[model samples]
Target: MALPLVPRAIAAQPWPALLSAAFLAAFGFVTLYSAAGGSLLPWAFPHAARFGVFLGLALAISYVRPSWFREIVPYAYVGVMVLLVVVLAVGVVGGGARSWLDFGPIRLQPSELMKPILVIALAAFYSAMPPRHIQTFGAIWPAGLMIGIPVVVILLQPDLGTSLLLTFSGITTMFLAGLPLKWFIGGGVAVGGAVPAIFPFLMPHQQERILILLDPSQDPLGAGYHITQSTIAIGSGGITGQGYLNGTQSHLNFLPEQHTDFIFSAMAEEWGLLGGIAVLVGLGVLLRWGTRVAMDAKDRYEMLAAGGLTSIIFFYAAINLMMVMGLAPVVGIPLPLLSYGGSAMMTVMICLGLLMGIDRRTRRDRERRRGL
Candidate 1:
């Protein structure tokens, strides 16, 4: 049955998650304003416009029906594949990765959009099957095949970070869909055994990234420069931060990619640990709300969709934090709302909106069943 738009006799809707998202969005805007203060109007206006557009799109997506979402998943996945192929054919090269499709005035990165689409598609694909069917190697091969095609193509673009994210999202959705423990252990063992033989295929730069993670000092001014300077910025923040817009590391260009992939370093440098904690708290609230929605999901598809979305957000938060703290190799993953880029910011917003829509539908169903 199609769930109603609103819960019967319910006094209120979930505003905490929406409010938390709003606060984060505002925080991002302020930081962007500060980060791009000196850039020309032409350069800055596009970002600002993109932000506004994404915010509205998120709000619109929040009202969509769960059934509609399910129907759209396969199409969305196919659409992403088409765009990926298009990107490979005529992508503009930048930052050692040719992953962005150039559309003259605007550059589009399809991988960012593909993350959530892949999540939804995988969730729906798995949830439709019988649990017993998926437990064996025969049934799991199709699932692996679905994931492997895009993964291989994306990796051919040489976008290791995004390819990893895609793999992470797909595997997580599969796990949520009901994969057995033995499967995980077996997969881990396979990966462990293959790492040695497969290590030689990694690009030289990719190898350098792993080595820099081990000892950053080896190439202080080259591969390790980002980590070294980021650590300094984070440490310089001390406890309370150096204050907004006054960060020497940020303003003096000591920290690279201060507005995009490494924006957290700027936050740490300017707002210190306290500010970082604030962002974490906001993210925590959003995550908790997502989990609650997933638990209350009216069906397996919704539950899996909600869970997969939550995992994507969690992965970005955890990976970005680790990268900024120098605890993990820098993977060029943006810090959700805090980082710049239209595709990433929009994708996260869409995920939150999807969560809200799912919550709304489930609540309505509960109310209807109670005759309220």
Candidate 2:
């Protein structure tokens, strides 16, 4: 009986996804340890602690029924929107963005919470809509409202990174819901055409970022410093790396946000191209697992929810990687699980927990069908 119970419990868990997360989190811990000048006091310990706590939260969430998520999504969305408004009114200003709500010992970024909730809300919305109405404007406008409203609020917070992330996740869901492809193509062309008109209205710093992206040397000591240092660190790594805890840029304080937004740069400096590839491969495994969950979903809600949630992680990782590599403008996006921040970790773990729950449901349903 004891032997049977051991395998049964082990078989019940999603080990592949769990192990992948563990690998990334452990890598992040070591990188953070190095970033702290070989100390764990500032960043390294807290990061590991947060991952553990959030992982537990995710596991608890995994046991929840899918119907419970569908039931709470509307209320949860409304609640988060309220928090965003609260943030605008009295939020703590950090890194030049008034995006956090102070609660004595804790500072919460409501925008992070919106990522997962928006996915669930949209998933519920599309799953309930009539199949015949999916192709109609009725499908398009309501979903747009769901996405657009929060985006406007976040922009008021002036967090361009979060706003862009929300837009991407929302649009990904809309596409997954079977919105016409021509709409996306037309919208893309229109947005592209409108960029010139939009350029002048952007904040000065925003304009500088775009300009620097086009020509980093134009402001080598100013707006382009972050990208310049990041590239130097990455390029210096070459093949294997400079060796653990021996990264010159980070240890010497030349790499800004070395423990957070630019942690990858620090890792590559010490761990080399191989370390970068290891991170990529780990993320790839997790992403492949997520895509499989979405494809294996039994209901429309589960499918959209899994796909959208998975896309949120993808966008976070992709934008941060590109931003560091100079392929995109700096927008302050943090690498998921690897960055030294609780808010993003919580949001991501919530998504993973929800995905786990959906995957569990999918597996059980398959077994039931087989039993019949």
lDDT tens digits, residue span 1-372, model 1:
887687743335577886777677666666665666555243245555676787678767877897787898788888989988988888887667878888887778888888888888877887788878877776578778878888888887888878777788788888888888789789989998998887788878877777798889999899999889999999998899988878888888888988887788887888889988989998999899999999999899899999989888888888888887788887788888777777777778888878878988898789889996
The candidate scoring highest on lDDT is 2
Task: List lDDT for all candidates, in order.
Answer: 0.81, 0.93
Query: Would you estimate the TM-scores of all the predictions?
Result: 0.92, 0.98
Deviation in Å, model 1, residue 112 alpha carbon: 1.7
lDDT of 2: 0.93
lDDT of each residue in 1-372, candidate 2, tens digit only:
256646755688998889999899999999999999999979999999999999999999999998899999999999999999999999999877899999998889999999999999999999999999988989989988999999999988788899999999999999999989999999899999999998897778888889999889888899999999999999998899999989999999999999889999999999999999999999999899999999999999999999999999999999999999999999989998899999998998999999999999999898888993
Clashes of each: 0, 0
Off by over 4 Å in 2: none
Best by TM-score: 2
Query: Cα RMSD for candidate 2?
Result: 1.2
